[model samples]
Each structure stands twice: as C-alpha cells, then as structure tokens.
Target: MPRSKRDKKVSLTKTDRKGLAWKQRIIDDIRFCVEKYPNIFVFQVQNMRNNLLKDLRQEWKKNSRFIFGKNRIMQIGLGRTKAEETETDLHKLSKRLTGQVGLLFTEKTKKEVLEWAENYWAVEYARSGFVATKTVTLPAGPLEEFTHSMEPHLRSLGLPTKLEKGVVTIYSDYTVCEEGKVLTPEQARILKLLGDPMAKFRLTMKCSWTKKDGFELHVEDSVDDNQSDSAMEEEPEDDDEKEEMEGDDE
Candidate 1:
C-alpha cells in the first residue's frame, strides 16, 4: 500500500537555520576580534543614523572594528562570568553591554579614542517619535521654496497651505509643530522637507577593556541589565541594520 503524502517529512530551508548560524558567526567573530585587538571599548550610540555610522565605519576600517546588535550573543562571546570569560575582566565589559551599545576593538590609545569620540557627532534629520527641539511657524504669503504641486502635500501634513498663482502659499501664519512634543510621522517628514534636522548622532564611551590593565570604567553604568530586551534591536535607530562578515559591511 502507498503511504500518504502527509507522512513525508519536510526539509528545513536555509532561512530556517539562519538564526542559529548567524548567532554563532557573530559569537566567533567577537572572540576572534578579542584575540586580534589589544583594546576593546564599550560604547553607546545616541540618535543613531545609519548613513553617518556607515561613513564612520568606512573611515575607521583600516585600524578599528565595530560589532553591533545581538548584545546577548556578544556577551556570550565575551563571556558573562569569570569562568566563561574569554579573557581576564572581559566579563565586566560584557556586563555593561546593555541597551543600544556596541563594541569597538582597536589598536588606538585610550586617550586618542576618547578624544575622538568627544568631538565626533553628526546632525541628522529626525525620524518619527523624536521630540521637536524648537517650534516652527510659516508666515502668511507665498512659500517660494515649494512648488504649486507641493501645496496638496503640505496641506496634507497639516500645514494649511494652498496654491496662490503658481506658488504654494499660506493665508495665515501656520504652526507646523511645537517644541518638546513627540513628533508624528507627518511632522517629521515636513521638518525634513523644510531642511530642519533635530537629531544628533553621537557616541559615548562607557568603559574599556585592555590586555594589560584589564577593565577600566570610563563612565558610570546607568543602564539596567535586566531592562526590557524588547528594544535590543531599536526600531527607530536604524531600519536597515544587518549582520555582515568582517570584510563585508552592510
């Protein structure tokens, strides 16, 4: 008698197995970097901008390495306890790897790295959920910067705009958004169109782990390890962040 088709076992696809393989690859890479580099720094990113970060990575590609995402996987590679640690005092560095943080492995001196981080920052267009830094108001009359076709779009964003002759115009002074309020999608898009950037991307050095001296605290730990892991892959920070092999960046 022939067996039923439902009795046949389905084979797992590459994608089904990718999660474990990806995690293992990241773990191995972290451990490998630990051996290759003498200094490892824990850093937190504020207002992360993917383009700006990619550019910074390209600039530092020659000497430094950055490992981001999967904080737990990184912790496993670095070791979470004294016995499991890859190196002496590495577990301490792993302990502080909570929140939106990444590892920087480099050969640069502590002073040099710290000084560079102090001055490194980029102004970027704010995305949805960010708080408006300042109030924006468009005065009554023709808005020459915008074309007549954009009048509909501006009005849709709650700008109260119309086309006067061939130009987008506002009959009365229009307030786009108020300061200190969380920005909606429309407000963010409008701000971007108006060339107003409210987000600043900056890196803050949290702590450092060195080969000779072991772990040294640069900034006091403010984040809780037990904090909700729901934001581990922060949605608002970078929409396109993904895993890449050492020489191949995304």
Candidate 2:
C-alpha cells in the first residue's frame, strides 16, 4: 500500500538527513586519510570485539590510522573510481573491498603489516543465542561463583542445584551446550558468569597499495580465491550502495 502524504514526508525527512550525514562523513574520512597517510590497506575482520579493536588502534596509533566505515567511502578515500583524485592508485584496492572490511592508513611497509597479522588476534566471550563452536559442559560440582541464593534460579534453568554448606552445588553433570548448536539463553549467561571465552578475534589482509605500486594482493591459505576475491564482484561499484554490513562485522 502507498503511504499517505504526511507519513511519506516524515519518513523522507528523517531518512534523508541521516543518509546525507553518513555520506558526508565517509567522504571526509577518506579524504583525510589519503592526504596524510602514505600506504593504504583493505583488510577484513571476523568476530571482532570493539575493545580489542580499540586496543589495536592504540598499539598502532603512533604510526597508523584505521577506519571501518561504508565500503564505498573507504573506496573513495583510496580513490575508488577516479584514479586522478588520489596521489596513489587507490582505485585498484577498491576491487577487493569484500566482507567486513576496513582501511588502514599508515607509512608502514607491506612486510611490516603482513608480519603484524601473524600475531594480531584476540578471544572473547560469546553471547546468548549464538551457535556454540564447541560443546560446553558444566560438570557436577560446587559452583562457587554462584551464591547459595542462586540455587533456586539455577534449578529453574534445568541445572539440578542445591545449597551445600553455603555453596551452590550441582546434583549431576550437565551439558550446557552442544557444538554446532544454538546456545540456550541460560547457557550463554552461565558461560559468561563462568568467565569462559568462545569468540576468537582475527583479521585478514585482502590487499594493500602504495603510491608507486597500484595494489599488492595477499591471499591467505584458508580463503578461497574464487569466493573471497570476488565478494564485491556482484556489488555495484557506484557511490549508491543500498545496504551496509553491520552488527558483528566479522
């Protein structure tokens, strides 16, 4: 059904403002990095944690700048289409902007960047409703983390619990989650409470560019070139990308 005149006006006004602001921000970000940094890299991230990314930024802050934004804006920053716009042939790097991508601006050499990838990773706790990567079992024992008052709550979640000598004790071993299965809400909460981390942080270098060289591509053994290299093959190369990768960027 078509919208009434009033509804259309309200929707258009609110959406247009946000859309324009986002585009302008992308343009400014790309321009700033291109003007200041000598090298540009397009990298992919998986299962990334915001705190971890911030830590990485701090680690490389003295020499590098990182931007995770609209891919087109990032592409434009590296001179996506108009080669003459940027000092370097950043347009070439735009071809590999696939998946959860971000740009790294730095004077660091390609070798240094690749070397850093070797050790750049972190592990984090998984949230509820996420699929378990591995089986998680809470063996029958006294759950010291839980107070005696939690015994009743734990029992409601299917854990056979009882208070024993002021400690929350389990009556039998319980399988909290199975590998490749969606984690129950209770399981996720318990895992977090147990301080178990299941999320692995990782980054990948898809391609890099410099003023002298157009783009130097790096392929990881685990990635399939046909698929990985062609992630944006079907995505339109214009400034009018309709959707953006969001939520968990990895």
lDDT winner:
1
- Candidate 2 lDDT, tens digit per residue, 161-249? 88888999988899888999887778877777778888777888888877657567776434333343324344554423223322211
**For residues 1-250, what per-residue lDDT tens digits would candidate 1 score against the true structure?**
9998889776666347448777898888888889988899998888876566677777787888888756777788998767788798787788787767888888888889999999988899998999889998889988898878888888998887877678888889988789999999999999999999988999999999989888888897664444433433322423225333242322
Could you tell me how far off, in angstroms, the CA of residue 187 lies in candidate 2 after the best superposition? 3.2
Worst 10 residues of 2 by lDDT: 241-250
My TM-score estimates for the predictions, one after another, are 0.82, 0.71
RMSD of 1: 6.8
TM-score of 1: 0.82
- Judged by lDDT against the true structure, how good is candidate 1? 0.80
Candidate 2 ranges beyond 4 A from true positions: 1-19, 82-89, 128-133, 149-158, 162-166, 180-186, 220-250
What TM-score number comes out for model 2?
A: 0.71
